[model samples]
Target: MCGAVKFEVHGDFDSFYLCHCRYCQKDTGSAHAANLFSQSARLVWLAGEEAVASFTLPGTRHQKCFCRTCGSAVPNTHIPGLLVVPAGCLDSELSRVPTAHLFTSSRAAWDHALGDVPEFSGLPKAT
Candidate 1:
């Protein structure tokens, strides 16, 4: 993620959700977005705060925060009283687990039963 931006969440997360909404899929370029939500945590930028940027989908509550240099998804607090953090961007491991998969009706068909697929240590050693 280029590590251009560094921040900290100072309090425990309220919930975690794997979001399968179409907007989430498109923005993440994946089946779903794993996000941690908190209403009380404070977000403090540690470095490269100037590099943080955000985009909101027109007429919708959807928003994405990212590092402008790397385009990696970052925490968003544009929504009042809530902070949304992309779980993948965290540098450390979390004890909390995903509470649910939201918007499952929009989940991609190909995303089903992915645990059955072949596992790889690292890209199958590139063939």
Candidate 2:
């Protein structure tokens, strides 16, 4: 993370999902978005509140908050009594794992063969 934005989740998260919807894919610039949902978790920004910016997908409830400095995702209030946390943004370990994959029908075609590809400890050297 950019270190511009820091936060803590005080309560337990109730659900976790890897969303493959188009919006999520676009926002994350990946195949899916890993999100943790909580009804009671509190988000307390420790710094760079001024650098944090949030955008609600024009006509939908889908929203995203990120640090303008490095464009890293940050915790944000989703709605009254609800909070959505991008799993990648956490500096600490999660108490539990992702519960499910959502909107699989909309997942990218290239994403389906990812697991079958070769694995590397780090970036593979150029041929």
Candidate 3:
């Protein structure tokens, strides 16, 4: 990701969720969305506030904020006092883990039994 946008979260997150809803999958183009929710935390944008853009799905509360330069997910406060921060956007390490996987019934079919898959430190060597 281009480092066009930078921010700091000043308070602890209330919860972290791996959301597996259909909208979330469309948002990330992946299995789920890794989001940290906070009711009291403050997001201090250090730079590129003008480059940050947001989109809210029509007729739904679901919203996404991201850096326009690199398409990397960023924090959003569209829901009034609640701040929804994409977990992957943080430069610092998190002490808290995901609280739960939401909407499991909508989970991707290929998302099952992922622990059995092979692991690699990086991209695997060519066959």
Candidate 4:
């Protein structure tokens, strides 16, 4: 994880997901991205908020923000206390968290499916 920004989780995660959505792929410049969804209070930006840059894709709520200095994606608040943070940015151990894969149908053919995790064609109805 990049050290440009520090973060802490203030509450339990609602869910963690590996997204294969086209928007995520483009934003991450990767085959897929893992995201942790929780209340915005769960995210504590210890540094670098001033260096954050954001872009919103046309026709969708797929907004993304990143640190300009290190080019690491940062959490974007969705509501007063809700946030979606990229798992790749965590400094603590992440192995205990389980992530379900979403938007599997949009995943690149070259990317293999993750073992055993539940996969969804789209966001889960409950989410």
Candidate 5:
């Protein structure tokens, strides 16, 4: 992101989820975090490795890495056998849609019934 960090995923993802845990919402600055999990995917940093920074929550398994230039989330190793890819960081197409929403109890109060919201093809014109 920010034209500095780029990467490639070398294997297929096995699962995808939308996480609504507090940490995820805070990390993503949104209602939830979309993540692709893979047991065999290899993350190959194509550029700006030096700009990659990571943080793990204290006393927790939640960890994240991001691009220093734009604070864009990037892939990071997960649980020794898996790779966590932020769906937004992927430049290519995904094989499948998110299978579930995790930690729904912690979803934002304003995030309910989103399917009813108006859809826009692009930026809505200013009223």
Candidate 6:
């Protein structure tokens, strides 16, 4: 099991996004990443805030965070309450439940094309 970083969902998930954008690739140190986008009011960090470290990219507002101890990416916010937890950071049960994939046009060729999940060349149509 991964280290615990607790939070509460303030609103229903607005959408789940699978980002194949270069920023996601660099941030996750992988081909792409899955994210749960929710309202900022829905998230609260219960512990381990001290172990989290974040970096802001040169031209983007997005900030990514990870655990300094284990090097596992931790959830950070785009707004308030909205937590972006790396899909791998979740247990098996949660990891399997992705809502959608974003930036599909930029996905790597070798990556398993998730045909079943909702996929968008960019962010999916709102709601």
lDDT of 5 by residue, 1-127 (tens): 6879888888888999999999999999999999999998888988898998899999988899998989999888646988988998888877688989999999999999889999999999999
lDDT-wise, the better of 1 and 3 is: 1
C-alpha lDDT of residue 27 in model 6: 74
Question: Against the hidden true structure, what lDDT does model 6 obtain?
Answer: 0.68
- Write one digit per residue (lDDT tens) for candidate 6, span 11-58: 455666788887888777777788766564345667777777788887
lDDT of 4 by residue, 31-125 (tens): 88888887634666677767888888889878887888878888877445668878877767776464688898999876885576788898889
Off by over 4 Å in 1: none
The numbered model that scores best in TM-score is 3
List ranges where model 6 is wrong by over 4 Å.
1-11, 112-127
TM-score of 5: 0.93
TM-scores for all candidates?
A: 0.96, 0.93, 0.97, 0.77, 0.93, 0.68
| Per-candidate local distance difference test | 0.94, 0.89, 0.93, 0.77, 0.90, 0.68
Candidate topping lDDT: 1
Q: Which segments of model 2 are wrong by more than 4 Å?
A: none
Q: Where's the lowest-lDDT run of ten residues in candidate 3?
A: 88-97
Ten residues in sequence with the least summed lDDT for candidate 1? 118-127
State the weakest 10-residue window (summed lDDT) of model 4.
Answer: 39-48
Which of candidates 5 and 6 is the stronger one according to TM-score? Answer: 5
Model 2 per-residue lDDT tens digits across residues 1-127? 9698888778889899999999999999999999999998888888888898999988898889999999998877857888988999999977797899999999998998677899999999999
